[model samples]
Target: MPRSDSRTRRSRTRSRRGVPLRKSLMVRLLATSVLIAVCSIAATAWLAATTTSHALRQEQGQVLARDAQVYDALLGYAATHRSWDAVAPDVASLAKRTGRRIVLTTPQRRTLADSAAADHAALPAAVSAVVNPLAVDSSLTGGTGATPIDPRAVGPYRLTAAERTALAASARSITGCLLKLGEPSQISYAPSGRPRVTTESLTAAAPVIPDVCGGQSRILTRPTPTEAAALHQLEGLVNPCLRRQGMSPIRIGLDYIGPQSIETLYAPMDAGRITEGCVEDGRREQLAPYVAPSALLFVTGVPGADTTGFALTGANAVRIVEVAALVLTVTVAAAVLMSTRLIRPLRTLTEAAQRPDQARNRVPVSTDDEIGSLAVAFNDLSARRERLEDQRKAMVRDVAHELRTPLSNIRGWLEAVEDGVAVADRPLTSRLLREALLLQHIIDDLRDVAADDAHTFRLHTERVRAAEVVEWVCAAHRDAARTARVALTWSAEGDPELTADALRLRQAVGNLLSNAVRHTPPGGSVEVRTSVRDRSVLIEVADTGSGISDEELPHVFDLFWRSEKSRSRLTGGSGLGLAIVRQLTEAHGGRVTVSSTLGAGSLFTLHLPSAAAPPLRRDPAGAAKDRRER
Candidate 1:
């Protein structure tokens, strides 16, 4: 049998499986807080960005529509004052009091002049490029020949200046091509503020109004009294800026819907024949972005815009992007740190656990968190490692000590004979042979420990005398007791010939007898007894020798365990003797027990499985040989 590596295997398992962890409580709490805070901030920022963009676009649209309204009114004022030189001068105040700008364009689609806003602001390039002032080329319903409206042939648009020019050019061009100054054109008027077109009263002229318009048409748009009142509201505004020009009070058409509905008013301008110039300009910054879409007007005329699109500003989008980027950066950093904090302690525990030496194995998990709990576990592992380590070292030291004595005796005498110090013949040879046999017993004891884990252990069951075997062991050891000058006593009850293995049964009893003789002093006594305890046969050997200490009693049968200060020291038997006895007994489905006092006597007990019946016949001579050798 080969020795098992149980100690090493057990050590490795303990080391690898049991390391403590250490993490700080405060650190864990802070990490948790950071995770929660970052998520909350990110969520809130997303919601805020979405909602704020929506609200800003809503507000910007309203502002754009209001601006469009002002443009519409200014065109009305300019046309109304173009006819009467007397009343035209008075209408200039309307432009000055509005805190805004105005453009007076001719019916021929020429800019007559401007109030503050247009005069100071430079026209956007896209607006400057809008040469087709009469944006529509058709008559009331449709047109044929060269005057047929081609909706795809839209002219340039004034986008850079927020299309102030688009407003002027759209109204000027549309009214010039579709309406007349004094003749009721094709447009049908609506009364009581409900505006509509009077298509029957319209006519057309070709040559599409030169560069100022796409064509010339006279379509009267339906005007209302409230629209006339809305036009009257413009009377006081245009004169302050236009009176010096000697322009006349002009006839204008106004369209209105609902009392509070928005109105569009139109006036005519003869820019080429004006006594003094009327000019319009615009802010470049406001119109640059819309250049492409605003250019869609001339071929299609002015679309009735009511701030048609939601205007979410670029600045608002930029802000949201910046905020989102910050949140993403913070979240990534937190996740990295969190994973690190979580994994650090476990790595330390792993390294510590891989160590082999009990003294060298320790985990540095001194934390107040989950890692701390791991630290505690590591401490437990360390203690267990220490215990097993001590047991291994002790077994090695004791086993060597037990084997050396008998081995040395054989080796010493053989060396003496080789040196011619002692004769290697007869009695000397017999003494050497006896010493060799004792050494062989020690080797066999070691083999038992080695084979303990193997699966080959089995008993050869047979029937033999039981009570007679006990009696015979006592008699056999009596000669050895006489040699030691120790009295050997024997007793038996229920003297029946029971079923048992003659050899193994004798071996268990002989071991107990030898243990008794080994521990007893020269004058001390050895006693062997047999009885049935409960259902099993019992054989015992008690000795008046230095008995086992209470503390060492439990470990008496451990392989190679010994306490020279206790009973096993004087027993002079390899400690494995009792261990082997126990093994053989258990192989027969039996048990062994022991009791002792420190300085008085000790009792060793073996309980064998009882046989159903005693042997009917037994070999007297063979049984006597076994009993005599007991």
Candidate 2:
């Protein structure tokens, strides 16, 4: 059971692994493109949300300040207007200042004023802040450190000349104290002439006094007159908001005081439910004339999420999906197109390859790529195979033709003597014997060709002088040349040596010599000569006989091919001698070439590589000149 279960599990695993790959190339490519696009789009969306969310979270203080400025502007506009008819310029001005699209709508969601008409549909109907100067919104009241204060206005705490001078003396004293304690300090002055002891590291310093600075570590200096006037106006607005909230009036110092002292009075206490909206409005009313407002403000980039964080809206998500679909479509189209082009040629090649042997099928080369080259090579191979098959059939016919004549002559003579048609005389017996000898010669030549073809022929290689081989061949064929009434002569030069099978080399040369002698007419001359050229030994057999024609010369080395078309064996020979010579020469890693001119005779040259380095021969005249110069 366990073994069967394991086998089943393996099969299931294999099936699972193979399921995805069974799809077509178009499906696979489209699926892969869609997968990648989805992943990329998702990753991009996630990364965008994460980065923007973290950045917005870090700039919470800046966001709160911008919100406060916008609210203040809106609140001022609402406080002055009986209706929103003249609010367009205000909305446009705020939008330009804040780099955001701004819109004003009534509580019933009716559009009143808009900075960008096109963006109106896209914008959420949720109000960012209530446009009531009498109301306070908690969203607009808090800041990063204390409440958001205008840095340019110092309020009642603005420093006088005497106060600045006093603060400078104190700063110098603090610097001395810091130096004594091995801390860095510098006296930095505000534009309002308030002096301060500052340090680069002190920006991160806590509010508590450090003993190193003589226990007088303070960051704030006295405020300017502008700040003092602003503070007076803010205190008056706060009392009215407190009164409306049913809270007792609060008193602020007419004398110069730091902002920290003033914030401590109002920030901790919530007067009443009415003041929840009232306090925020009072703060905005005090600072409304000072700060610039933004054009638009809101945050939402994630779907089904809050407006304050990164949220993807419906419209944006749809656009992304459409783009991904387009990418997938293009990818699938390209894959299908390329695969189709590739498969067409492959199909043609397969059909051609599967053709029957007799059909001799070939594919057209239509391109210059790898597939086209493959088609060309296949066609060439087919042509060569067809030619070889034809040659094989012709050779069989020729072999049969050669053997028939000799056998027929021998059989005819013997039957004549036996039947009493002719007497078995000496001349008749000699002719029969000659016919038998001719048959044996033909058989021997066929056997050599067969051995060479079957790779059973071998050579015994040795160093041989070209001149010696030529001399021996000429001597062996001298009698035949005499009998043919042809003059035979030979010469040697350079004493060139070759590594070869001596018997085969001699036989190859003898065939050429015999052919030359046989073909030469009466008084015609046959010459054998040896020389060295191009680091090879050359043996030339030139005959002043009936030379081969240009059209017939190329077929000279083909088996059973002869210049004479007649099937007369006595005149044309067995037609295997030159073919055997070619086989033997090739076995020795050499080649034989012939050149002929009509009525001018022929030259056959055997080219063989030198077996050993030869001694250099120098002219005696050149040697003498060198010696005289020395």
Candidate 3:
């Protein structure tokens, strides 16, 4: 009774687990999809709100890199010209290329050249960079200002054609000598327009020649007359200035690439302060006739955007929010459409399942997706249920008919005795007892079938030698086999130890043995054999009997089913033996199978898992109870 209640509880539990408690599928799908869309939209809006200024600054950085080249071009023009008077065209070109307004002015804030009309009020407040070729304000150098002199415009120090030819000849002579001595030499030009003699073999001994060819110093300064005159004037201006500052006067070197590049008479670091204003005055005084005066370049947009500004505005923000909302709505719509399509089949299945008559209902599979696969599975389940229902009905009728015959026989005999129509003698009493026993046997078999279907059958599993079970079953059925005039034999080979329920195992094996012995004709043989095969224990019963036909073989394990559709005890017992055998075997996690020929013989094999067969191992009662609980 407890086992029956457990089975009922399990059935209810399974039914409860199949249903879910929450919103409907469509609502959940729409909620999840809309949430994701909303999160994405919110993230986009947040990023725009937080990073607009940073993005604008990054864009400005890229513009700065691009305009660095244009700045350098304009600086070169300023370096080689006398003033910004003719610079309007160049400034306009630079503005066009860089997509920015360009304005040039003197250090005194006087406008020099403007890409647009001279409207100083429209320009930005700060200067972009200074344009000074002589005493450069390093910001305009673009990090390549190793020398203050613009390398492209090398004023008076630039090499003439004759000077280059003379230098190249000298370099070739050095190259020839180095090559002869198995060394390397090349002539390269410096940005200052000086020929530099280069050699790969620094460790080699120098050739016997003039110091100019292979010397470490590459610059050979030959100042022009104009440069000489400028140097004299610069020295004259620097002495008085230094004396006024109370710093000692120092000797100067004029054979330099630029006006500020003075070879020092004192610490070079100290010379910067002494020559600060003096160098600027001297370079402009020297190159006044040669190049333009220093000017400040400014780049600007409209008045309000003098500084960097955010890219997002109120209208843009509204548009972004609108687009985000539209996306969320579309996503929700898609989720609803998809969920509706997906749940249609499930609803059909649910309706069919709710019907009282299940034998004729099936779900239609329209697609090959997971939902469609579920529909296919539902249809298969419905068909299987129909077949089982038919089998159950037939089994009920068979049980009724089987009990009716024996019951009628017993009742008739009793009634005859009661009416004094017949004597209640020993032979008559024995016949009545046999009829009662047959009824008892049918009832017991029906109970087993019910227990098996409910999955409440108990198995007291333990380590038992399979050979012992076989011997016990064979011994129990030995007398019956002898009475039927059939030879009963048993044999065992290999280790046949396994974990199994001993009473259930015996019942299942005994059923096979009994069936085999009954079917075997006189002078036939029934053998019970136990062996180990592929980590499993096999208990087989072979019989030389009236074997079953191919068409009727598959029905052998059905409840109360017989090959011959009759309840004749002479040819067939109550046909529940094989069914009980299968149920008990499966309850112990084992399998029973049969092979038969029409007339030759029949073999029934029981296979049980024996992978963990240990010698002298047993399951305690506690462990068995724990297993049952699990």
Candidate 4:
């Protein structure tokens, strides 16, 4: 095998080993998408868990508050009623409001009122609380370090309507007096219909009592007629207990402000405690019959039943897993779609690039992305390669055709002279020398073209006049134009100067003039013109000849190209003149352009960089004569 082939085979083998999954674009994209999806799901789950925990805690607080409300309502109901006959409606209302099952039963477990009685549900094993007006649950009632008996259990102390109205008027009088004394106060009636004077800033330990309002307080704080009667009965019940405990009998009031009320009695601490105990016992005994019997209260369906804290249930767990799986699947599928779209164009480019015929192999451009731009650039490169290939083949044929005729003629003439069929005379020698010079001319042109192509063509640049170059080229072609019966003329707009090789400039313009004279018919005019334009000098050669066709105009300056493809070498010339003109013009950092129309004349323009003109010398005698004439 060839060394290059073996190396290529080894390289192909290495490439076929393939990339690892981690390095592949598709695999990386898939993994990245999955990672993003998992992160998103995890973040969403964390937020949901946090939010749900907060909401459940708030709900737990609401449940406890509602439970307290239910207990307070039932305690009030039992404090007023002697039985549970109308208590079923209240239980149902509490259950509906709190979204819980409330059940009330006697001490003997006999059902009193059950909100869920219609469903016949079994009661919970534990009781929430005990409902008793004589001994209330202070935790449920929000009372602390006070009597267990509910304050609402007034019983015989409940004020009559007539006494309540009379006491309300007294309460108003006290409130008005406090207001006049610059003390803002409001009137509040307790469950017993006894009005109390208080202010927003009032605390139980420190009551607001102005000097002028002290008498009003005394009047309002005094028991009403109905309360007085109840107080006398309560005192009668309490004094006996106090006497038995060796404590002095005390006058009982309708309300107890604080421990200060007991301090006023000058009673010892033990005596004060015993007095409070005795008062509670006597009050319970007095109000026992007017309230409901003690019952066992059962509340069910409260939130946060499992005391181990929050946890996701089986269904919720399954749903979360399903959602995570769906997200991952969707993300991976989308990644695959995007990666395929991205890699497909690259694959097409690879396949097209690998084809042997690059000039013909083209990839389709479907998107306006980077891949599309790459494909467009590749297509342009292919087109340029194709044009160069055509030009290469045509150059080979034209060179062969151009050299073959002269060689054949020279060979035939030498053979004839050697065979004694022709003389080696001056005319024949002249013909032979002309043919040899033509060959040398063609070789020289080819050498120049090769040097330019290799970037070895050097220019000895200097300031030269464009008009002088045009005149030289026109003068050289004047004899040929006259012999062909063609009129040659030359003109200049100004003495335009340019920085270039004078010899190369003459050669370029000479080529154009020669082409113009040869192509112009007899009595046709060939014109050479020079003018300065902007920072460049324009050398134009316009000829009234058989103009080039639109299709052939573009390739006029192409190597070895001729408008008359079938014309002989003698008639059409070597076809390298215009091409050399272009190469020489471009070597000078300039350009040559040709424009022609069918049946009309052709124009060739050389655009070269302009140079500053030298200063003109003034003639002293001519200046004196011109001044005298003025």
Candidate 5:
């Protein structure tokens, strides 16, 4: 019907039509479930593959470590022995410890020893390493840039039982002397039974050897007869090379410290290098006959074990795909069911909202979740709206009835005067003025109530004495009480003060006093009391009148409400006095309450916020009088 209504309807229609399937809650939920399922499957497959690959690498690494151990054991055996005659027991022990097949062969492929000979297992074509004492594997021996010859190949340098015992005793003596000098040292024997004095400081360039221990060093560092003979032979071989290089011949000792040569001072740095090369060559030649011949070392995995790398078979891959598909289907199905259950209640709410009769339309609350709570709250809001609609209708009727009565009286009096049937005398004029004033009062009360409803009611707040406000209102209404032959009185407990609108406070108190004076019988009394209670100033007006019933008490402050259902001005004054009092009290951030009993009186209380009282001023004359007494 209206342009805005047409536009709103069109907009709603467009929104409904424009919604796509992908944007739907159910579809999106299904998509999300599928995506999560896919990611989970992919992650699981990746983790499994990665973990398996790592385990395989670890297994390969362990196999390599065992192979190196076998190689090292065999190399040490060959280095010390002239032949492999006693190597069978050692080979079998290494194979048992390492869980591998160990086979040693000559360069001609003649099997020297085999741990798997009883099984008759053929040798692996590829060799693992070479067992050579003359040319050793430095990596296996943990050596860096040292001699290629294995240190175990001591040959003639090996000390006899007597020589070893003498060197050990000498080493113990040196260690004891070093400890007494506050320099701790330990005896460490080399492969040749040469006991050297080692300390924590020995790793440095200049080792600190105490002078007191010098005699012990001479005993320990002196080469034994067996080592002396070998060293003498090695020096003979090394001296020939030194002479060929034109460097002075140097004497060698067990410590390998040669005297500095003055003849080689002008030679290049290779002069020392040439001496080291000659020594290395001489030792290899001298020890060559004492060690076993070099041979190939063949180390294989556990007999009949799989040695190929890891691989995923075709069947396993198919199984993984099937499992992933199954997971996806179940996830999507569960998402569909869950989204449907969640959307069902929401659809019910939407349909209920779209209906024109909102008060009657209610969604069934079948759950205790947030959605069910929303339904309950919506039903409560609908009930409140219905009650307010009824109140609005009743308020319109009451306002009309209140305004029509005074208007009818004024019209009737004017029509009588114009028709020449009544005189416009002083008494008649006074009655007309009273009726007009009554009408104006009703209009003003309605305006104030409307202002409160619209939240525009304002109060100019100030600090006023509560006792004064109560006494002034009572004095203003005293004449009315006298005319009605009702006794009116006022009292105060203390000088209670209030932070409030003085005018509004008075108007509220006056309304209560006037109402009490009007309702009370001719001989009845109206009393006003002021006191402080709970940080609030209480101005209570209690009247000895025909009291309100319990049924009417709740609606006493309701606008356009009166105890007199007949709506007569004689019994009640426009049914708005108490309502205006409530509005004014609330504007000052205060509250008014009434308690009444049938056949007894009603007490109306205005509880306003209390203010601190001003300090009392001292009298100058009283101060002088007290001073003279002191």
Candidate 6:
């Protein structure tokens, strides 16, 4: 149970660990950008489909209207003459006029004036019921006991009577290609025809003559009222034939197939947008000649328009669309994934830069790219740091050796003084006292080095006047400069103001000046200069003294190190002068560097970083304290 509790605690702890990808800036940006891309694609597709549907419907309406005009003109021509032979020739003329068959059927359901084929058995059923009524009805009308030929005859007879009235109203007394129907209960076939006086009954067993209309009267027209405007719609979708004489029949039903719309209806093709809309509107329309339908004419009543019908309904367009959408989905997914993969490494590198203890300890990456190069560079840096640590250790050893020699001499002189080995008033006694002070100063310098390393070297860091510090150091060093016969001059520029511990900065600057004065031969001059350069302030101490050797130049600031320690016997100076200079300058967030030559003497440059003030921070030891307390 304890172990299980520990596991549960670990899981709960992980839930609170750092930032999650869902919360990260980069992840949120990635998701938002990808969603935008998806929405743009879908919206564009809908707009394209809507626009195309509107265009096709507009163009279709115009084609259908033209076909109607042609059909009406042909009928007018046939009503002027009373000949059956004339009907075919006129029908053939009209067929040539609109480049489509002009079929005429008699009331007997027999072919009378067909422009194409008399053998076509696909005559519409509604036409057969009207134009070729039952033989029982025919016998009933003529039988003596059967329902008398009364004017009150209704049902089919009433329907026929209404049509006859319409036919009579259409007859032309004055002929300039007009319809004429004199004898009733009949349908005639004469392309250029007049009303027949009373023809012998062969097809309909009576001296019953048909109405002469538009050359040949059609009791049941090309398309019943049910098929009126659909014929034009069919013409609009018709395939174009330059000859305009072939039967490119598209039997449009709920389930009928040929080369589908995308395959043949259009001339040139683009698979870019195949299936436009869905089966939410899946109705079939027999647009027999959808291509260049100007030559076709269909006289039909509007078939009950299934407005739900879609033009591109076949599996071909749907398949194409499905394939395109699938490819698009995959492409989008792949692009997003690839993009994420590319950024993942960069994000890792950024995290590594922020938390370098984790970053630098890892092995160098293996890749032939810039990121791999960066890893190699980091490895080189880590190695360099290790070497510098080794150098710092060597410096510590060197400092100890330098201090031990002076300390030993100081201690031996003190022990001898206690034992009264030296005679009273001896000159060596004065040197011995000075040496003891040097030893004490060196010990203090070592303490400063340790404190600097620990970052616990406290300073009353604040804004102080640099001019005041410089003047005081110069005044204190007046006696030494006079003893050395060196003119030590000081100058300040701008405000000579800076933020630092005043005492520390004064000590550091004084060390540089004193070091320069010590090295200068008699008549040699030391000048202290201060200036504000850009955002940083620079303090320089230059002298004409025997300069440092190239070999010892770099180690000038090392603790307890001095090129000429014996030269400062009167002042009882410690080799810690330059070392203290470096520590104090650094504590103020400034650096001290020396430029020297074999004979031209040294110039120490103090470069201070500009800062308004240090940021307020909780003591770094706070976290350690908390951990210890826990």
Candidate number of the best TM-score:
4
Candidate 3 lDDT over residue span 1-630, tens digit each:
357446434443443444242434445556777777777777677757655755676677767765676678877897677778899888888877766777888888787777766454666677788887665555645555444556544455445677667656655776776677677767667433445455664521223333434542232333434445545666776777778878776555433222232212112344775565555454445555667878888876533344565456565667668767876677778778777887788889789879837456876666544555566566655655666678768877988889989999999999999999999999999999999998998898888777665555677888899888988888898889889999999899975688888998898898888888878889999988999887778999999998999877877887787766767867788888998887776665667789999887899998887847432332334332222222
What TM-score, computed on C-alpha atoms, does each candidate reach? 0.45, 0.53, 0.48, 0.55, 0.51, 0.39
Error of 4 at 3 (Å): 45
Which residue pairs clash in candidate 4?
none
Q: In terms of lDDT, which candidate is stronger, 1 or 5?
A: 5
Please provide, for model 6 over 394-498, each residue's C-alpha lDDT reduced to its tens digit, 9 standing for 90 to 100.
667766665777778877777877799855466776877767676677677778766766657888877777677788889999998999999989899966577
Task: List the candidates ranked by lDDT, beginning with the highest.
Answer: 4, 5, 3, 2, 1, 6
True-structure RMSD, every candidate: 20.5, 25.6, 19.5, 21.9, 24.4, 22.6
TM-score (C-alpha) between model 1 and the true structure: 0.45
| Candidate 4, poorest ten consecutive residues by summed lDDT | 258-267
Per-residue lDDT of 1-630 in model 2, one digit per residue for the tens? 357345434543443444333344455556656776776677668655755665567556555565677666676555444456777887778767765566666566566777777644466756576564334354675434333333332323346777677667776777787677677777665444565565555531324235445434443322335445655666688778777767777644332222232333243354454543454456566644433332233322223325465445555566557756765666677667767866898898888778838556777766544555566667655655666777878888998898898898888988998999999999998998898898998999989887765667767888888888888888899888888889999999878888888888998898888888877888999999999888878889999988999878877888887777895654568888898887776666667799998787999988777876442323334432322221
Alpha-carbon deviation at 175 in model 5, angstroms: 94
Residue pairs with colliding backbones in model 5 are none
Comparing candidate 2 with candidate 4, which one achieves the higher TM-score? 4
Kindly give the number of clashing pairs for every candidate: 64, 22, 2, 0, 0, 29
lDDT for model 2, on a 0 to 1 scale?
0.66
Error of 1 at 491 (Å): 7.1
Model 2 weakest 10-residue run by lDDT: 621-630
lDDT, candidate 1, at 110: 46
